[model samples]
Target chain A: MNDTVLVLSIASAIVAGTPILLAALGEIITERSGVMNLGVEGMMLVGGVVGFWAGVNTGSLTLALFLGGMAGVALALVHAVLAVSLRVDQTVSGLSLVIVGGGLSAFLGSSGDPSLLQSPNGLDVNPLFPQSLRDLPAVGPIVFGHDIVVYLAMLATVGAAYFLYRTPSGLSLRAVGEDPAAADAAGLNVVRIRYLATAVGGLGAGVGGAYLTLAVLGTWQNGVTAGLGWIAVALVILAGWRPGLALLGAYVFGGLRGLSFTLQLAEVDVPSDFLAMIPFVAAFIVVVAVSANPKRARRVAAPAALAQPYSREAR
Target chain B: MSRISVEPRAHGGAHVHLGVPVASLAVALLVGAVILAVAGNSAFEAYRTMFDASLNGWTAFSRTLTLATPLILTGLAAAVAFRMKIYNIGGEGQLYLGAIVSSWLALALPADLPKPLMLLVFLVGGALAGAFWASLAAIPRAYLNADEIITTLMLNFIALSLMNYLIFGSMTFWRDPSRQVPGGKKIPESAQLPALSGRLHAGIIIAIVCAVVLWWVLRQTSWGFQLRTIGDSPAAARYAGMSVSLKVLSVLAISGALAGLAGAIEVSGVTKGLEPRSLATDIGFTGIIVAVIARTNPLGVVPVAVFLAAIATSGTALQGIGIQVEVVFLLQGLIFLSVTAGEFFVTNRVSLSRPASTSASGTSTPGSDTAPVVS
Candidate 1:
């Protein structure tokens, strides 16, 4: 392949994979706290629409990204109240939360008039940092030539890995998820930990949604996020609940999807539609493949109290 | 707000169903009315407009009836699968398979065949196709204990993409070339489902009959008992010598067959030709809501299906009134959330005892410990 084609493939793959990576990382945290929020898709859709409108109106990409993250957190708040506070069925409540977010997103989206907006490339062409580094071929421009936000996103992945495993709060969070009753007896605030984890998870989901509208496609369309949110959910399962590996899983799935477009360009002659089904097909395959490793399977950290609603027992 | 208990008025020994289903439905409509009021639309006027558009004249009436037909079958499909604790979200896929098979059957039939016989072939052929399609996930779920929710959901997309490939890419038999819209060939005249009145067809009758038959099988037969037993408690069912794997497979197959039957009926009775967007109809998805609202009861599927059908039919009316087509989606979403939340009331009650609030029944969330005794 030509250098130009290779550069484009990497760039596109990063853009495509960024959302899933962000979402799966967020989910890893949420699940680590023993709460499985299935409303990721809904949260992402809300983020996409809200961020699209905010970016255009404020004429500030930064504000748009911030607002998108807030929107996701806002939706997550309702889920927290229902599943965490009210102690409702996690599956039903999460699904219902999806319904609410989806409906609200679509309705609010209708008023914004999606096509009447333009996306600003939130990037700078400056070659200031280490002149020698800029001169070192495509390993520089394609990867390092990206915007400041991409760098922040990558840093966030590392932060998440550390936050989940290295820190005391992370340990406490894991303890709660593993055994909420034990955590409660140990004097840990299980409810507060869950709420914080969920909100953070939603924030991650929002960033992912904004990445789709602002960086990748640069335009809005109805249901454009498609099933990417769901793919992220499946990614967590594929990652076996490790934040560090989730990044790799995201790129792998993202690369397969990106290659579908490249194959079309190369005239590989396979039905493009069939190739599009690769990620989902890959998701199922990965899940089945991972089933053989008992350690990995057992390591899948779902909070002991993940799906169950918590209502303290009376004395 | 004044607090009132949901207590029985009578004191004598009695057995009367509290009609949670009917009350919950009423609450949904009431909330819908309130939403319309908030949206600057007159609730009463909107209802009248909807009634007029969907059921005022014969044309409108038939449209309503036609819409409800597939919904009934799909609702039943969801009920059957959910009864086994298997959430078969791939109803859309099963529906597509049904349409594909029924369409092919229509094509292969002789021009001289009677309408009744052709209809039977289409229906049975559709059911078998649906069952066969559902097995894709059922096998893996039963054997591997794979998450049914994810597998079934992904399979829906696979099914749609598969059909799209067939009509748009490969399968020559189902393609209707003359049609600008990408769709399958129209069923021959002899194979078409006959109309009952205006545009309502015999498919409605067939769906209703099947629903009644299922209700009997579920409530009055040994097989139905077995399915529910497995559904309610798979471990206990296993201890009782029931084949859990077989039950899972059987329930999914039945669910798939019902969804497939809906697809066949739609093809023969309404569309007469399969198309890319035709199967994208919300019946499969909405049927889940219908099933939940009906509390997974077969007899309850009828009213819930019609109710969902009402909201769907009224969606076009909202479009005509300077509202986005997404309004229908919004209402649909609300229905889903409301029904899911409503199930909480039916199954579990929260009661908090304090100095001011003392009750032996359901109450608020801040309760300490009020789980009811089995005795």
Candidate 2:
């Protein structure tokens, strides 16, 4: 209830939501091109482990982030082969990818020195707003006092919104998801668009993984991502195939997540376990409920090829 | 006839139809080899050591069978649900429920009951319990048109926590009273499944029989016909007068039942009782890969289960050779990817021959289907 607590809560929410927002945006692009990369979690797992190990061993923060993104794209290429070229069931291929990712990440992190790499200090990354600006309003402190990734995450959302809704290629990508056969017939390079979009999606998801390790935990652990990948998947459902709306949903979920920690600190009566499960529970309830509403369903633009394998014979 | 008219022209671009799944396996194996070399062991010797530990002796072979039993059932669980175009991603959770129920039945029943009767009840009770648990997802899916993927997945975590809560928090049904280990009470000797060989148990035979029956049901029966129809095309199935809601529920229930049966057999046979930590074993998700590699065919589950079981048994064995168990874990993941991709070889091929197919590149959009003929 205090002003300080409220300010901190809002700040934490933005930070926590960064990963989900990044992943959702990437998934939006991939799905827009009629490819559902279920391996976001796997991509994240590989990214998290590889990035953490590489960064800590080399001690170059930038290299860590780069390796993390490449790790994601590397995993994405496997998905591209199965879901795109071979035209296997997108969902099956993706889920399988997650198993591979999770298992591999777990194996690599099971050993190795824990203290090899240090968490990057935010002092340099944080902005020094004039105390005068800090006094301006509640907005200044809550919005400006943060690390660099938080700002970039928001910028990426804006970029995704523009790319998905405003651009010509975006329209073509959406058209592919809506009807790949029709897109193909219309002279659209369906496979090319899907490949690039999926790879880009991987890049975004990888950044999310880096945010998790370098910003959130500052340490590597097996199964560190846990089920956050599923949360990202649920975010897509909640967003209803719209990238702009995903940002809002991620923030809301992130707020609930932050609130759970606050309640724990305050020693609130509610069990923290139940509270922590809120985002997933909320995602399930919101997506199913929204989809149930005829109005909401009509407004939401789910790609026709969300989970289906693309086959010329089927077409 | 003597001079073959002209050899049919193969598509120029059709050099390989095998996809990423296949490629990833090679990549994974290469990565594993690198890890092995890094670990100060010869990759070839380490693999040979793993095979020796897993498949060289009867003890290991029997252990593999014991492990394969549950995997086959879980794979069947995934395959059954998939045939109806449903994603029952919560097989892990469902298995937990079945294990809890079976353990409860083993403990509470009249201590004098015959073993065969007890086994039958245990199997049915566990399966029905799993079916009941799965119905939670199926009903929402049928009535609310909910995405089963999220619900089922969330339910798995819930199930895990619920089992932990019962044993670790409240209720004394299965919790061990004295032991410091995170475990549960042992099931009665009368309730336990009898082992058949060195380590193999009747669960293996039961799993095999179940696979055959499942294959028959899916391939030859009217229900199977209906299921395949719906899986291939929901719209067409609806027009054919099939009750979509009922079909979805039935398939998911059957799927849940098989998974539940797996839990029951494990509790009654090798595990001898359920434990708080038992749910963490990943027979469920691994089964999903098995089902996929087999292309959702029940009969194909046997080999897939055995191979995965061998890999699992050897995971610990790798530690004996100065390699981390994680290496085996990585290999399993890679194999899942490869097996999933290998399915293409058993089903379809790609050809880039006709201009019409290439026309897809020019259009920049998909061609609309005015009318699609039902195969």
Candidate 3:
């Protein structure tokens, strides 16, 4: 491949991977706190559309990103109320959220001014580094040619890793996930901690959605996330609920995704449709491989009370 | 000091109230109305248009029935598996495989064969193909202890991609070359299901029969009892000598087969072949909503399927009048959310209670398993 093509492919992979990385990191925090919010896809969609709408109206990228994150938070709040407060089945709540978010986004995106769906200039984030640095040989394109979100995603990964492993609050979060009753006995305020974790997770997912609209596509469309959120969920499992590992998993999947487009661009004989199946198929394989040994699966990761509703009186 | 608490109803004493689901539906519709208003559309007129378009006339009603045909079978598919605590979310994928298999069978069969026999082959072939496809996920779930949710969901994408590959890319055996846009070859005329009414084919009968059979099997048969026992408590069922693994595999197979049947029926009865875009709608996903709203009761799936189908048909009709069809989805989502929330109230009773001793804060035992019933 030509240097320009290689540079573009690598750049595209980073851009594609950023959203998944952001969403997966949020899910890791949520799962680490013993709450399984499966509505990441729905949350992302709401974020994407709301963020896009904000961008079109306000013409401010920062406000668009903020609204996108808030949209995710709003959707997550519904999940928190249903799964956390009402003690509804986590799976059911998450699935419902997906339906709601997808439907709402589709309705809003299609019914409004047709022009808004096609943002003229697209929501491209300004590159973090100067043009001179970005144009510097092979190293520049790979390292300096990306927007601010890519950098933030890297920082978030490291920050999340430290927060999860090296901090006292992280220990308390793990304790609540492992044994809420014990955590409660230890004066951890289990409910409050869980609620906060879910909210923070929502914020991360929202930012991911904003990144999709403002950084990647720069336009709004119904189902624009295109199951990226679902892939993010699988990425979390593949990462074993560790934020840093999630970054790695996201990029790998992102590379595979980018490869599909790159191969199509290269006029490869393989069907692009079949190639498109790579990320999902890979996710399925990883999940099956990780879970093949039930004992090992239990021992390795997966928060014990991950989907279990917590009520002080339930036990 | 006062506190609020909830408790599960005593076994066998829980009253099955019709009010809960009804109230949930009412609330959902109210929410939909609010959404419509927010979108600058007349909520009442939109709903009226939907009802009139789908239910006002005999022809319109038949169209709704046609839409409900696949939903009924798919709903049964989800219902049966959910009863066994097996999450078979791969109905969409299974349906696609069923369509492909049934279409292949119909094409391969002698063109001069008797119509009834050809139809029978299509039905059986479709169900078997679906079962086979479901087994791919079921085996891993049963043996490897892999999470079925991820497996089933991932398989859905694979199945859809496989269908696309067959018609659009690799396999040209099923593709209709004459068409500008790629689509599967039409099934033999003999294999096509006869319409009982305007575009409402014999598949409706098959769907109803399956629902009844599933309901009977789940309620009266020993296998059904075993499945239910396992669903309620796997450890207890295992202690009672039930093969948990075997049951898991069988349940998923049955679930997949039912969903596959929906795909087959759609191909044979509705579309007469596959047009990938038309074939891959939200029917399978909607089946999940129907099953849930029906409370995983096979018999109850019939009405739920028709109700959802009516909404879908009406949504399409509204699209003709310049309204977006996504409102249907919004409503469906609202219904699902409200119904699930309603389930909490139905299963558990909540009430406020005052403490015997006056204190600034109520001393209520939270998360206590055997807290005294305040009533």
Candidate 4:
């Protein structure tokens, strides 16, 4: 590939990976607090449409992003109420959120004016650096050409890694996830921590969805997030619940996706459908491979009480 | 202030209670109505229209049945695996694989063959294909201890892409070359399932028969007993000398076969060929809801599937009246969420009591002090 093509692909990959990275980071935090939220896809859809709707109506990008995150938080709150407060099965709760979110988004999106929903000029985030910096050599385009969200995603990854390992509150969060009873005994407020972590995760997922709508696609479509939310969920396992690794995994998957577009552009003879299957197939293979070895699986396994509800009275 | 607490019922709460399901449905409908009102629509009128369109006449009822036909099979598929505590979420994929295989058989078989023989071939071939696809996930889940939920969900995507590739890419084999739009060729008329009346095919009867057969097997057979035993407690089943891994594989295979049969029925009976869009509908996922609402009972699945199908049929009708069809999904989601929450109530009892010690601050979390005792 030519240098320009390579540079463009790398830049596109970074852009594509940003949303996934944000969502994964959110999920990692939620999982660290011992709550499994599988409704990321549903939340993302809600966020995507809500962000687009807000953006079109208000013409304020900041308000759209904020509302998009709130949309996600609203759905995640249902998950929290069911999984944490009511002690329902976490998987079922998450799945319900997916169903509700998907249906609601479709309903809302369809009811809106088609013209308003379509962005003739897609929403674009302001770039972090000047055009002059972006016009430099190969490194300039890869590093300085992207929007502010890209940099924010990178910063969030580093912040998450630091918070999880170095902070006292982070230690308490991990303790609650690993053993809620012990955490409760330690006066860490287990239920509160779980609720907060889950909500935070939802906020991240919502922002991720907004990023897709406002920065990536710049338009609203039903099920626009597609299976990217699910991919983010799997990315959590691939990253071994580490925020830093999640960034790497997201970029890799994003590159695979970007490669498909590049290959199509170059008129590669392979079927586009087969190329579309690469990321999903890769995720499946990785998950199966990791889970096949008992010792290795345990090494990077989910929290001990990941899906179990914590109730002091029950014990 | 009054405090509420829930305790698990004794003797496994085996007795059936009609009130629980009724209450759950009522709650869901009430919530849906509130949502409709908030959206600036008349909830009562919309629901009345929905019911009228789905059940007002024999033709509408038959349409509902036609939709329910595949759901019954897919519901059974989910019920079977769920009974064995295996989360087989790949019914959609398995259904696709079934359709693909059955369609291939319909094309490859000589047109001169007897109709009955061709029909049998389609059914068997489709079921086997579904079973084969299911086994792909079951092997890793049973032996490698891989999470079946993730594996099955992933397989659904791959299977969908493969189906699309076949119909959209391979022109000579699956695709109709003459057609501009991407779709597979129609199955031969001789191999098509016989129609009963007005878009209703013989597949409904097959679905009913399968449900009865599954109910009988689950209730009366040793295999069913072992399966339920494993589902309730795999560790205990293993202690009883049952091969847990083998049972898991067999259960998933059976589950996959049923989903596949649904696919074949859709092809030969409903669509008459594989169109990628028609084949990948939410029937498979909806089947999950059916199984859950039916409490995983094969016989129970019939009524639940029909109820959902009626809603789906009405959804299409609603679309004609300028209401988005997605409202049906919204209602379904509400029903699913409420039903799952209601399961907790069915197996447990709640009571209102006062706290022994009054706190001046009144800052304690609700339900934190209420103890639940396993009956």
Between 2 and 4, whose DockQ is larger?
A: 4
Tens digits of per-residue lDDT for model 1 on A152-185?
6678889988987899999999888888878888
Better of 2 and 3 by DockQ: 3
Per-model TM against the reference: 0.88, 0.87, 0.95, 0.94
lDDT of 1 by residue, B1-375 (tens): 223222112332212123555565567667767866776667687667777877688788678878999999999999888877788877878998898888889998886798779888988999999888888778877876766767776677677777788788764878977778677887888878878887688988888898899999999988899988887688999999998998888889999999999999998888887776767775787787778777688888887787778767877886676555566666667777666655555555433333245554444443334433221
What fraction of native interface contacts is shared by candidate 1?
A: 0.38
lDDT of 3 by residue, B1-375 (tens): 566656776532324555677789999999999988888888888999999988889999999999999999999999999888787888988999999999999888897899989888999999999999899889988988787877888888888888888888755778888888778888999989898998999999999999999999988999999998998899999999999999999999999999999999999988887768888997888898899889898888999899999999998778776788888888998999899888777777766866655565665554455343343
Q: What range of 10 consecutive residues in model 1 chain B has the weakest lDDT sum?
A: B7-16
Per-residue lDDT tens digits of candidate 2, residues B149-258?
88888777677767776676654778777778657888887787887997688899999999999999988999999998898898999999999999999988998999
Decide which is better by lDDT, 1 or 4: 4
The local lDDT score (0 to 100) that residue B206 gets in candidate 2 is 92
For candidate 3, the docking band is: medium
Candidate 2, residues A1-315: lDDT per residue as tens digits?
Answer: 225667767767877888888888888888888898888888888888777777666767678778888888888888988888766678888887899888877777665443322234311233546656556556766776667677787888888889878999889988888888888889888778888989988887887887777666677666777677778888887888777788888888778877777776666766454665667677767767875797877778578877566655456
Q: Which parts of model 1 are misplaced by more than 4 Å?
A: A1-4, A112-136, A292-296, A299-304, B1-47, B55-58, B350-375
Q: Which regions of candidate 3 are displaced past 4 Å?
A: A1-6, A115-121, A293-299, B1-5, B11-17, B351-375
Clashing pairs in 4: none
